[model samples]
Each structure stands twice: as C-alpha cells, then as structure tokens.
Target chain A: MAIRQLSVFLENKKGSLSEITNLLAEAKVDLRSMCIAETSNYGIVRIIANDPAKALEILIASGFAAQIRPVTAFAVPDQPGGLAQVLEILEENGINIEYMYALVTTIADKAYAVMRTDDEEKTEAVLAKNNIELLDEKNV
Target chain B: MENRKYYQPEFETMPVEDIKKLQSEKLIKQVKHVYENVPFYRARMDEKGVKPEDIKGIEDLYKLPFVEKSDLRDNYPYGMLAKPLADCVRIQSTSGTTGKRVIAYYTQYDIDLWEDCCARALVAAGADKEDVVQVSYGYGLFTGGPGLNGGSHKVGCLTLPMSSGNTERQLQFMTDLKATVLCCTPSYAAYLGESLKEMGYTPETIPLKAGIFGAEPWTSENRRQLEATLGIKAYDIYGLTEISGPGVSFECAEQGGMHINEDHFVAEIINPETGEPLPEGEKGELVFTCLDKEAFPMLRYRTRDICVLSRKPCSCGRTFIRMSKPMGRSDDMMIIRGVNVFPSQIEAVLLKEGYTPNYQIKLSRVNNNDTFDVFVELPPEQFDDSVKSISAKEASLRDAMRNMLGIGPAIHLVPPKTITRSEGKAVRIIDERKLHD
Candidate 1:
C-alpha cells in the first residue's frame, strides 16, 4: 500500500527555501524525503514528512499558497524492473502519472518511488492488491 | 504682483564676463572663510601647501583637492561644521543606507543661500508669485523637503509644504489646493499620477500646470510618463544633499536640460579616471565648487554623477550651462563578467518595453562565477496571463539584457505590486556576492 503525499508551490527567490524550512522546523515536522521540481521562475516543493496535516497547516499559516494532493509512494526491490512493475500496475488501473521522482533510502537494496497520479485511492488499491509494498517510517 | 516682477529675470541672458566676475568674488570670500574656520579645510589646504590668498579667482580653483562624499562621512556629525555649534541653526544628513550617515550643518546664512538657489531654479522653470506650489519631497535629514519649502517661500508662491510618503493625502491636497506647480521626485510623480487615474480623476481635472522632479537620476522616459500622466510640463531639478538639495539647477519650460546656478556654484566636467577636466559637451564626472556657501563651503566637490555639459544658450533664454540627465554613477557601475553594466541601462531597456522600472538586480556567485538575476514586478494587466506572459517576457528580457549588458541575466517576473515600493528612495540592486560566509 502507498501513502498519500502533497505538492507545494514554492517561489524561486532568495530566502524562499529557508522560509519554508523554518516554518516546518517550527511546527516540529521532520521531512522523511523531499525533492524540488524547479523552473526558472517558480518551483514545486514536494515532501513526505512525519506529519502531513501539520505541515499543510504550517504552510498555510506562512502564506505559501500551497495545495494538498494525494501522491502514491511505493517501496520496491532495488533490482531491475522494480519501478517498471509499479508503473505497469498504475497503467493497468487507468492512472496517468504527471511526474515522479525517487526518495533517498537507508537500505542498500531497497528504494522508494514517489509518484503523482490521477486517482490516489484507486492507485493505492491497485498497488495493495498487486502486493506492491508501500514504505513508511517502520519500513525505512 | 509687484513682488513677482522682481523674481522674473533670466540670469543666463547676462554676459559671461559678469557671471565670471560674480563667481570669482564669491569664490574668494568662501575660500577665505573655509580656510580660517573649518579645521578640515584648513588642514587640507596646509597639507597641499596652498593658501587662501593663492586662490584669486575661479580659474585658480584647481589648486584645491576635490572633496567627496566619503570626506563628509569621515567628518560625520560635527567635525565639518565651519561655524560654532550654537550658531548652527539647522542640520541635515544622508540616509546612511550604505554606511554611516553624513550630517550637513547649516547656519541662518547658509539656509538663506540655499533658498535663494532654489528660488532661482523655480523662477527659471517659469514659476511665479501667483503659482500655488506643492512641495512633495521627503522632509527631515533628507534635503528635498526643507530645501523646496524654503525655495517656494522665497519665490513668493503660495507654498504647500506637503512632504513626501503619503500619496493619498498628496492627491487630496493637490486636487483640493488646485496646485499650479508641484515639486517631488520624478518616480513619485509617476506613482501619484497613476494613483489619481485609478481613483477616476482625469489629468485635465487635476489643475496641475508643471512639476519639478529631482533627488534621483531619472530618464527622459520617466519624464515623458510623468508629463503625460499629470498633463503638465515636467522639469528636471538637479542637486545632491552634498551640494544643497534639489535647487542647484533646474530645467526651463523648453525642457532642454537643467541649467546650473553658475553664479553660486561653479560646475566642471572632469575625466573620472584621469582626474583631468573635460571640455563642455563631453560626458564625464561632475565636480562643483560652492562659490557663495559660507557655513559649509565645499571646494571642487567631486559629484560622481556621469553627465554631459552644454554651454549653448537654451530656448528658454537662459545662458547658464545645461547638464544632461545623468546616465549612471561612476561608483555605482557594476562590472559583471568583464563588462560594465549600469542599473540605468536596464531601466531604459525595461521602460522601452512598456514595463514598470520597479525591478531589483540580484548579483550572486555560483560555482565560483558571477551570476545575475532580475526580479521585476508584472503589471496588473498581465496578472491573469502571468504564467504564459512572464515566461515570454523573461525570454525577451534575457535577450535584451544580453544585448545591453553584454550578459544574459535570468529574469524572474513576479505578480503585480509584489516588489516593495519605497516612498523615499527605491532599492534596485542587491549584490549577494558580498554576503558570502
């Protein structure tokens, strides 16, 4: 099973990243994994944290103009076709992936893949029924 | 009406010999007073092996070393005061935005001379006793406020001492007072003009006849916008706090250029690099010699403003030498990637493209190399199309900047009114390279 994630809009300017991190730091939220999808002007800061609800609240209070959307994360074998299997399942479930990127992992032979899809719940069911493992704090 | 006639003469029409003789007399007295009273001046003159008696006329001014803004800063609060502290009736200082504030001392006589200069500038700009003048320059340590206040009073205009910052109140006062002439920075004038339009007030109903703008170097594009928006003739008033605020010179109704107050202050263009004087009509550094100032007499003070001087008689019948609008400061020139770039050059490019000149340049170092980025505020009309228009505008700006600055800068177009709008001085450049840990 995969856990839901959120994508936040970040302005690409000085002190922007520090401002967001400071907000999350104040809220006592630890980011498990994060990545920045950046263009020249603005960026989308996606993060998987210990507490998503609290992170969303802190972001809103800081006037970040962010949005909470469900993204699927899958833990797979760090071998060939590990990510391929997960994408094939999502394709069969009629789900379109806008973008996806990998997260850092502690285990040498295992990695987690984060993906943005059309339907989070449907994608979560497909991954669970297909025996695809979703990585959480305990798994890491 | 009788008082108005006393103030209406064109000083430029006077013979060059008469102006030269007047300047020489004033220069001799000013040099003697500074040498005797101001310790800094006395010490500097002694070190140079020059005496007050050596400076017989304006031609001998080269004997003095040029004073600069840093010299004023070194003196700080009271070291530069030529008169005793008790005799000093007024004091003004620079904003100290870059470093320590430079405080200027003025006695009753100094104040009177400053007002006279401003009054001369106003008279040259076609202001008369019947004109209701609204002064919107920032007051206090900043010279723009009090300088114009005294000048307008001397010109016998019904002066409105509305110092800058509050635009809404300024508009209300302008409309209510039916002010015929306004004094302020050119940028503020444009902002006020835009605000008035937003409030549904047409330019014709504003009752403004003319404006005198200065304190910062503004381009002709800004002047045209201010003139069009206010539906009034906009004139450039040139002066620095070091020289005595916005009354050192002014443009006439013909709008050719600003005429220096040759009788009170001697203007010279000098090669900035070589420190040698340049001929008229050539662009170089401006150095002013205060001929009549008593309390704080500055001799050949080097003003880093890069401009050209022309001695041709203006259409307004003033024979005073005219200085073009300054292009950039010699000190403020930014050398990026071996190419010299100026903020004013970027300003010209943006204004030509129909964008607000409200932008900030951020210079940083990445990968051990210099990087430049421009953050600009998008206009309201382009807000809805921000995502699409900003990208296109960014591409165009990158190309334009490359052509002008010789380097392509990453342009970031933000939403409307996002950048801070300063009521006083606008901060347009940020060099992050200096902030390295």
Candidate 2:
C-alpha cells in the first residue's frame, strides 16, 4: 500500500522541530507518522501525512526544504511477536529496513507499522505472498 | 615565470592638456550619439532644457544630471539600449540583492572596448603574455568572468575560464594548467588560500604569481593575507555591472590605488547628500560618464561608491586618475545608535584578524528599541577553539566596531564554514527590523 511521507532537511537547532510542527499545523496538514534522523549539526525529519504534495508545497513556500517519499504500511495483528514475524520474513527475503515507525490513531485493536525498505517492490511482493494485510489508501 | 614589473602611470605625468583634449573630443561625439540614438537620454536632455550642441566639451559634462542604479532599473530590459536588441551581442546584470537587477548590453564594439580596458588593467597588474591566467570570477549574466577572459586573451596570456565555485577543481586546474594569474573576489581568494593550506599545498609549489581580486570591497589587510598565503601580489580591480566589469579600473603593482579608465569613462567625486561635486582627495560618491560606450552610454552615472580620488601621477606610466578602493555605498550605510556603519567596515576588521568574511548583520527591534547582532562564520580551526577565547575575540571585535561605528553590536561566532558561499554576488547584510515593524 502507498504511504505518503515528507522528508525535510533541518539544521539542528533548539526550536527547529517545534517550528516545523507549528508550520504544519498552520497549514492544516495532518501528520500520521513521524521520525527524525540527526547528525552533528543537521537532521532529516520524515513524516507520513494525509496529503504529501500539499504538505511539501506548504513547507517549501515557507522556506523549509522538503521532499516526498513513498513507503509501505502493513497492518500487524495486535499479538506477541507480530512485528518480529514480519522482520523475520523480510530478513529471510534479504530486505533491509531503513527505518520503521508506528502511526498514531484512535483505533487500537490492530497495530500498524510503517516501514521504509531498500526494495519496496520486493518487500511488498513478499508480504503479499505471505498473506499479510498491507494497508492501502482505503485503510487510512 | 620571471619577476614581472607592473607600471603605474600618473595623470600629471601625461600631458594633461592632451588627455583633456582627447576626452573633450570623445565626449562631444558620445553626447551627439546618445542624443541621436537613445530616446531616454534624448527625453532627459530635452527635459533638462539642454541640447547636444550646448555641450561643447568635457566641462559641459557637469551640466548633465547624474544617472544612478535607480535610473537603470527604471529603464529595465532594453529601454535604455542605444542600438536594436538584434545588434547587441551580450547582456549582463548585477544581482538584484537589494532591488531590481540592472541589465547592461554590449555591442561588438563595446565588448572590444571593454577587453581593451581589461587588458590595460591586466598589463598594469604585471600580467605578461607568457602568464597563464586563471579567471575565477563567475560567468554568465555576471561580467567578471568574460571580462577577465577577454583581457587575458588580449594580453596574450593563456586564459583559464575557471569560473567561481568548485575550489578543488580550480586548484586542480591551477596545478595541472600551471596558472600564474588569478582573478576572483577577495573573499573567495581567502577561501581558496585556506583550502590550499588545508590540502598541504605550499605557495612555492603553486604556479600562481599574482592575483586581481574584486567584485566586492576588501581592505589592505585582507589583500596582504591573500598575498602572503598564495605567494602572489594581490591587486584590486574595481568595476560595476552598469559601467563594465573588472576593467573599469585596476591597481598597479605599486598598489597605490585603482586607475580609472579616464580615456573611456570620465570620473567625478560628489557629495552624497547635496549632489555637489567635491574636489580631488575628498571622500565622496564616485560617479562616471561614459565617453565611448555605444550600445548603452551612461552619462554622469552616480555609482554611490564612496571613495577618494587622486589626480597625482602614479609611479607606473598611465595618466589615468586613480580612486581609492571604495569605502562603502552611501545608500547601504546602516545607522545604529547615532553611528554610521558600513558592512565593508566590519568586513575589514574581521579579515585583518584572519577571519572569514562570511557574516550576517541582523538588525531587529526589541521592546521598542533597536538591537544589532552580528553572526560571523569562522574557519573550522577557529570553530574548534575554546568558547572563552571566542568570547574575548568578540569583545575586542565589539570594541573595534564601537570605535569605528560608534555602536556596539551583539556578536555571535558561528562554526567554521557555516556560512553559505555564493558563486555570483555575495549577500552581506540582513536587516530584520523592517520585517518586525
């Protein structure tokens, strides 16, 4: 399933995260999932949003450098070893997960793990063959 | 490369009477051409209640109103072009960092004249036909690159069209091509010098012998550092996009001041506030009147660059009038706490302390009061040093700025190489006061 993610290049500063979040709120872009990878002086803030294009446009118009990336989201059963089983399958299929984070939502019965993999097509195919419930646009 | 001697010609050394006679003839012809061709000039002349016939010689130049950057902007695109767009071969413009970018057109004759002026400047800087000149000034829409390229070609030097940016590539080209003459902005020259030292390349190993640095204002302290680091004699080349590029004037090896090409463009110093002409040696706004320009002839164009003029002859043999490297632009002057401060003034102090000129000055209002902050981007080595030492440095900088500008600004020492490097025109100051208000 398609996951719209916003990748932003941010210089490491005290209020940069808050600034971006405030900007998103002002633009009315709803964020579903978020993660940040930081180095010594700068960081990349990635987020899955309802409307990736609109979020990116708003960010750029506000002078924040941002890009869009497509990732995959899989609905996992809310049970023990649910994520572990998916990881094992991906590892067996030689798929490297760059990063994985959870989406925040009101529904708590089923768990969803959004992942960015090295080979998105292969990872999706492997998950599909294994009968894993991959969340699509309809699910969100 | 052998030791090449640069020549400086004094205007007095030349028979002034003869030079004046030549200027008068050129001026008369130029005035006639401007009246016949450019409608803008024609309209302005008509509005002034003056005619081409009324301007008899060089003395009549004073009767014309001074043209300025605003004038160029008012006549944007081809409004001021004397010739048809088809006849113009090239167009260049200054970056509209402050306002609208001023576009300049060049006919084939204009380009040739420009190259001749540049060649004269290069010769004055001790460049020889055998020298391999590396032009680091940016190309395309900026006149620095092509201006130097043409001049180097005219001087019979092996010209390297290595435009600005790509320091590593520039060094490689310098070493591989054995470039001896470098042309670039003074700030970038410092950056390149630092890069060479970091790479463990000594001046003795480098083929560079002399440099012509301009496109931005720099001080003698910075020039000395550049020379010492690169093992080259650094000369200042002054010009603006409106008049021409690097060829408007150049410093001879004597390093007294830049020699304005009086043969083509007439130079004058005037009071910035009153528009009244100032005598020689008085620090005022520099203005020019193009005498030989064809496609876009400018008359009494007020450059706004504040500098002193010297009519005294130079040791080298050219009879052209010399102007001090500009102090600053009157319009760009910032007033803080009843003190006048120019960005170039702070730049000079920072450069003398072996600091990069990558700085931004932020002016803001706090509690209905004006506050000034300076963020200086330092080299990596300086960035690694103790914060205490940096604080002391800032204190001294504040003191020096106060002494020079009569105002103290909060100084922030940023990490080395934190400031962005520009390939074309560098943005020097940022005023946030207007935004907040």
Candidate 3:
C-alpha cells in the first residue's frame, strides 16, 4: 500500500536543515524515516513522519517549501535475503525504483522499506502478488 | 451613458492645435511661476542664459534647461517649492532611498488636478459612479494609493481603500462590495488573480470588470495573462510622483499606448546623451514640462524613462499624444558586454516561457568580463524530485533567455521563496561589480 511522504525543498544554506528540524520538533512531529537528495545549489529532504500531514503543515507554515506525495512502503523479514527478494520482484517486473529508504518501526523481526518507483501502482501490485506484506500509515 | 464614456471630454478630445495652444499658454505662465518663486529654477535658467520670455510656447520648450533628478535632490525638501509652505496642503515623495528623497509639494489645487488625472484614468478603464473601485496600491508617502483613492471619489464610485496586501481581507471586501474596478501594480493584480483561482473563484464568479495597473514595468504578455486570469480588460496607467503620480497618461480601449494628458504635462522625447529632442516615433529618454503645476513646477524635467511618442490619432477620440509603454528606465538598463539588457526584457522572456515573474538578475564582472547570471525560482508546482529533470528545465530556460537577451546567462533554478521580496516586489537586480568598483 502507498502512504503519504513529505518532500521538502531546502536551499543550500548552513543551518537550514537545523531550522527545519527545529520547526518540526517544536510542533512535536516525529520523523519516522528520511533521505536527502542534494544538488550543488539545493537539496530535497524526503521525510516519512509519524504525522506527515501535521509535519507538512508546520514546514509549509514556517515558510519551508514542502509537499505531500505518495510512496510505497512495505515490511520485509529481518533476514538478509528478505530485502533482496523484494528488489528481485521489482527488477523482474521492469519497474524502475527511483529512490528507496528504510523506515523506523517497532515491529520485531521485521524491517520496513519505503520506495518511490516510476510506476507506483505496478510496483505495489507486483509486491502484493508476491505475497509481501504492505504497510500503511497505521502500522508505519 | 454617452457622456460617461469620456471624462473631461473637452480636454481629452481637444484638437491638436488647441491642445498645443493650451499647453503653450500654461507653459508660459508655469515658466514664469517657477522662475519668480523658486531660486533653483531661476539660477538654472540664468546659468543657461535663458529667461521665462524665451519659453514663448511649445516650440521654444527646448530653450529651457532640463532639470535632472540630482537637481531635485540637491534642492532637497523645501528648496524646490514654488508656493509658500503655508499654502501647500500635501507632500508626495518618490519611492527612493530615504537619505535624499525627492519630495514633491502639492497645494490643494494641485491635489485636485492630480485627482482629476486619476479620475480620467478610471473613466478610461470603464469606471463610473455605479462601479465600486478597489485601490490596492500602498498608501502613505506612496502616491499610487492616495492618487487612485481620490480619483475613485472624483468618479463617484464606492471606493474600497484597500491599500495593498492583506490578500484575505482584499478578497473578502472585493466579494462583499462587488468591486468592479481594481487598481494596483500589475504584479499584485496577478497575485490576486492567482489567489482568487486558489479560493475556487473563477473569473465568472468575480465581479471585477476592469483593472488599472501601473507603477512598475510589465510586458504585454503580462497584460494578456492578467486579462485572462481576472476576466477583465487590463489597462495601463503611467505616471511618476515627480509629475503628480498615476494619471499623467492612461490607456484607452484600443490599448495601443497610453495617452499623455498633454493639457497639464507637455512630454518630449530627447537624446539622453545630448539632450536634443528626438523626432516623434524615435525611442529616447522622456522629458516633461509641467504646464499647470503650482507648488513644485517642473520645466523640461528629465524623466530618465526610455520610450517612444506618437501623434497618430486614436479611435478613443483623444487628441493627446501617446507614449508607448516605457522600454525600461535609462538608469535601470545594464550594458553587459556592450549589449543593452533590461530586466523587463528578461521578464518578458520568463513570462513567455511559462515562468513566474519572481526572478533575480545577478551581474558581476569576472576578470574584466561581465558574467551575467539569472536566478529564477522553479515554482513548487513545477518542482521535480529528480535533479536531472530540474537541470534540463534550467538549460531550456537559459537557452530561451539567451535567444531573447542576445547574451547568454547562467540560469539557476532554485526552490520557491528563496528570492528576497520587499512589499510584494522581487529585488530583481544584483550587480556585484559595483561592490568591486
């Protein structure tokens, strides 16, 4: 299943990230997972927050460029080959993964992976056909 | 209804000869008025070996020495006043740095005439007593607000004195009052149009029927955008605080160019370098000679605006000569590698290429060569997650800008809200070469 993720535009300025984190912290929004893609002049901080709608509201209200987007998140077994099987399924389906990151969850003996694929619907369909468990906002 | 089509039709539709005659008579008196009352004008005239009698009429307008902005600054607050301080009722200054602002004094009569000019603009934009005029130009020291506010009253329209910003309140009052006319800068109008769309209000749902936008340089493309967005006929009103503010000229339905109020202000195009008057239709710096101003009379004042003037009769029945939308201010023109590049030109290209007008121009001299760079915000709606995609967008914008500017510039697509804006205006130019110099 797909869950909402926050994509924030950050200018390449020192203390800008700190400013963003401080704003979210003051609002009591917990960051569950995050990854950053950087260019020479700017960066995009992708975040999966426990309360993504709240985090987005605060970030945008505080004048940070932010948006809500859908990305697929799924739980995999803790074993090393668990993540490989998911990648193998995606590679076989010819669906390209744009970016992927790990999600912080409390479920024991299980790891969560968040991914943005070129064809999100096809990726989730393939994952469901492969009998992999999908994660929604409720669980992750 | 027929009379409502033209405000002050006697003057607006005056014959060319009569208009020129009226100007000559006013100029003769104004020249004498400034010479006898203000020492600054008299000294400048004496230095040039010219007398008030030398300015016999419009033909001898060149006989008067042109007054530059520095002359006004040199004379500061009270040095340029032709009327006594006790007689003057109001003061309006240019929106410049505070250290040496060019303060313009206005008598009650001057304010009435100024409001009449603004009323003429409103009427030209199809405004009347039945209309509700919403003025969004900033008030206090800035002439846009007060100028239009008084004009709306003169036209007998229910005026909403919404002096810029407070977009939420602006929209509320606009809907509640059913404002039929909007007055503000073109950029602010665009923002309002966008906000209306965001609030799910379409052009059909809004009551605005016309807009009079001025005080900043905007392209014809921008006019088209505003017209479509607001579903109204967008008109251009041209004026400067030095010349009694927004109603020196106005656009009629034809929308070819703005008609100069020749009865009060005599306009001439002159070679900026040599001060020789250019023939009609030639692009040059605009000069004005205030014919009827009483408190702070100006004689052949150099306006530093580059534009062309034409006498082709307009269908609007106005005999006043028309001046094209100014190309750009003379001082605002940048010579990058011997090529003149104006921020307006860059802005036109940006708007044509589907970009917002919020952009910053960065210019620096690197190792004896001018390095021109333009920073444009990649609006959040157009933001992409992939860096390559954004870089491609920047490359295309750079190519388009080079095609228009005749000089290539490095274009950086930064995130939205990165550029600094004061009072809803983007600081467009940053010339670092001045720092090194």
Candidate 4:
C-alpha cells in the first residue's frame, strides 16, 4: 500500500508558506507531516495530511501548483542508527531515496518515516523482505 | 575634432533661433500637406476643432490631436499615408501583437533622411569612411537592419549587411573582415558577446571598436556588461517604425542623453494620461512630429515611451536636443528578455488554449540573464492525480505558450486557487530583477 503526499511548487517569495498553511487551517485539515526543499528562486513543499483529498481540494481551490505523489511510510526504531538501518537496507538493494520526512508518533522509541524512491515497488519489496512494518493509508 | 563630430555640421550645430525657425516652417508645411492629402488625419484634426492655419509651428503643436498605437491599428495599411502611392518607394512595419501591424511608408528621400540620421549616430560614435561597419539588425520589414545598412553607406564605411542571427557566421565575418563598427540591439550585442567568449575568442582578437545598439530598451547595467564583454563603446539609438525607425535620435560621446534630430523631428514630453505637454526634464510620454519626412509624416505621434528631455551643453558640440533613455512604457506592454510581451497577449493565448485567464507572470534576473516563469491555474476537472501526467500536461501547455510568446516561459501548472487567494491585489506580474538606475 502507498501513502499520499502533496508536492507543491512555490517561488521563494515571502508569505507563500503561510498562504498554504492558512488555507489548510481554514479547512480544518490536520497535517500529518511536512518538509520543504528549497532552491535560490523556487521551492518544493512536501506535505502529508489526515484527509489528502479534502486538503488537495482546498489547496487547488486557492490557486497553488499542488499535486499528489505516491510515497512509502514505515515504522523505524527511534534509537541510534534507526535511520542508518533503513538507509543501509535501501543502499544494499541499490535503491535511491529522492527525499523524505518523519512523523512524531506516540509509541515510545518508535517513529514513522515517509520517503520517496525512484523505484517504489522494488524499494517496498526490499524493506518488507527485511520485516519492516509498513504503514498503509488506514494506519496513516 | 569639430569636423569629426558632426556628420551634418549646419543643422547639428545650428543656433537655437534658426532651429526653431526651421521647425515652425516644416510644421506649417507638413500640416497643410496632411490636411489636403490624408483624409484620416484631416478628420482627426477637424474632430479636435483644429485647422492647418491654426498651427504656426512647434509652439502650436499642442493644438493638434495626439496619435497613438491604436490609431495606427485603426487605419491599418495605407489609410494614414500623407503622400501619394507613386511617390512612396518603400514600406516598413512593426510586428504588432494583436491584429494589424503599424506600417510606415518611405520615399527615396525619406530613406535618405533616415540614413542621414543613422550616419550622424555612427559619426558620433567616432566612425568614418575608413572604418568597417557590420549591421546585424534583421533586414526587410524590420527597420533596424535597413536603417543602419543605409546609414553605413552614407558614412562610406565598408558595409557588411550581416543581418541578425547566425551568430557563428557573424563572428567569422567580424574577425575575417576586421569590422570595426557594429550596429544592433543591446540585447543581441550581449548575446553575441556571450557566444563570442564561449567560442574562445577574446575581445582583443575581435576588431569591433564601437557599437550602435537600439530597437529595444537596455539599462546601464546592460551597457556596462556589453562594453566590458565586447570591449567596445556602446551607444544607444532610439526610433519607432511609426516615426521613421531607428535613427530618430542617438547617443553622442557625452553618453548623457541621445541627441534627437530636432532639425527633422520635433521632440516633446507630454503627460501620458492628460495629453498635456510637460516641462523639459519632467518624465512623460514622448511625442514626435516628423519635420522632413514626406511620405509618412506623423504629427504629435505619441511614442508611449516614458522619458525626459534636456538641452544641456554637450562635450561633443552638438546642439540637437537630447532625450534620456526611455525609462518605461506607459502601456501594459513590457519587454521580456529581448522581445516585447504584453499581458493581454498571454491572456489571449490562455483563452485560445481553453484555459481560464487566471495566471501570474514572474520575472527575475539570475546571474545577469532573465528568467521568465508563468504560473497558470488549472481547472478543477484537470486536477492531475499523478506527477507524470501533470508534467506531461505542463510540457504541452509550455509548447503552446512558447508558440504564442516568442520565448518559452517556464510553465507551472498550479492548483485552481493556490496562486490567487494569496495576493490581495491580484497583481499579475512579480519582477525581482534589479535594473540599472
């Protein structure tokens, strides 16, 4: 299964970030996780929300260049080398992660990471082969 | 030094009193001629309650109605021509954005006078019969090429009618022929400098010593860049196809302002909104009245360019009135990169492509080059669910947009409302480029 993420194109202009959040706030859309990658003139805002469809609808209605992207979310031990362990598996399987961010979960010493890969299915297969607990849409 | 400076010493250094006398005489003659020959102009004068007898000279110029870009469109081809068809020898027109282009008729004498003005520009830049002149402005229909091509002939320079584009071939000729003078737009000069360096030719190896650049707006920043890169002195020439093309006025060695050929054309600064003449040095819309042009003489024609005029003493000893580089345009039209672009043109493109007109154009200068980006709002039904499909749609839209606009603007297919709800003013353009003051 795949978790949905919103990748938005934004010029590195003042208040563009707030414009996105303000619209989401008005629609009462809860943000699950988010990350922003920026260049000198432009930026890409990646976001995860509780209701992707409703959030996308509200964002698109406001006139943003927003789109949905399929990504993988999985449980990772929050201790030392937790990130390293997942990276080592992907590295061994020759999979490259485009970008990623994390969600703060309530479980002790455990957190969820959402990542995009070039080859989605192959990356998921290698992670699942190593007994990683992958979170689907319902769990997310 | 005096002989080297003025291409035509008599008019260029004429006393202010005599210059005024000539202007008044020409204005009187041109007015009566237009009234008798061109009914279109006569009707406009009549509508404004003005007659040819009422206009004595440049002072009475304000009494005449102003002609604009749209007026040319209304008249189309030869509707506004002041001379007979048999008398006209040539025609040149600007590539208009919407429907009909603004056409300018030229007689053999008109072309001669135009070349004389260009010759004055070249001589002002320190060129003479001994120098090799290469004209790279596009030929035919476009005035830049022919104006300078004819002017180079008048100056008796070994003329190279290279025309525009074919940059590699341009370099080969520049070096092979040892061309010492170049005439082109400032942007094309910059591009040529870029390509020349990329081809591993140093400025010293190229024989170009001076450049006469016009047909587009350029900044002091652009001037500095081109001068440094091309290793040549850059001069500005100003004109419009409606008012006899690129040689109406030109920069002298003083580099303060371009000297308008006041002997052949009367230059005025008028309030763009009110059509009232502004005092000298106050920036306003530029107006021109052809004093010597016979075929397509325009009276009080508004250029839409915002600029100021000065009569200060010049080191070059030319008494012709000077006009500052046009600061900006009064209309919605803007020069993007090197091409003229209008927001209305882009809006029309969007409508023609079945897209709503909700869009934003962003311009920025990154590392001395312009980056044009347009963000268009997609309809809710076209809500792309996948990145691949969305990118594919964007690519196709980009092709259509590039076809509409001369250059391809980076297209951003944004959601329906993300671009609009943010800006309170609904401002269509966001320019981040730092321009030369």
Candidate closest to the true structure, highest TM-score = 4
Ranking by DockQ: 3, 4, 1, 2
- The residue-by-residue lDDT of candidate 2 on B324-431, one tens digit each, is 988767787664432336676787767777777878788765532358888776554443212344568778888866655545888776543345557855566776
Count clashing residue pairs in model 2. Answer: 8
Tens-place lDDT per residue, model 3, B80-186, is 89999999999986632213556899999999999999999999999998999999988877789999999999999999999977989999999888999999887
Error of 4 at B414 (Å): 2.3
CA RMSD of all predictions = 14.7, 13.4, 16.3, 7.0
Off by over 4 Å in 2: A1-78, A83-140, B1-13, B85-87, B97-101, B332-437
Q: What is the TM-score of each candidate against the true structure?
A: 0.62, 0.63, 0.61, 0.74
Q: State the RMSD for candidate 3.
A: 16.3
Interface RMSD of 3: 1.7
Top of the candidates by DockQ: 3
Candidate 4 lDDT for residue B216: 74
Candidate 4 chain B: worst 10 consecutive residues by lDDT? B381-390
Q: What is the C-alpha lDDT of each candidate?
A: 0.75, 0.77, 0.86, 0.84
Per-residue lDDT over B398-435 for candidate 4, one digit per residue giving the tens place of the 0 to 100 score: 88777666568888866555565454656788877654
Better of 3 and 4 by DockQ: 3
Q: Give the range of the ten consecutive residues with the poorest summed lDDT in model 3 chain B.
A: B93-102
Among all windows of 10 consecutive residues in model 2 chain B, the one with the lowest summed lDDT is B380-389
DockQ each candidate and list the results.
Answer: 0.07, 0.03, 0.28, 0.14
Per-residue accuracy of model 4 over A54-136 as CA lDDT, tens digit each? 88888767766677878999998557898899999999989988777886545566689988888889988998999888888
The 10-residue segment of model 1 chain B with minimum total lDDT is: B380-389
Native-to-model Cα distance after best TM-score fit, residue A35 in candidate 4, in Å:
17
Worst 10 residues of 1 chain A by lDDT: A1-10
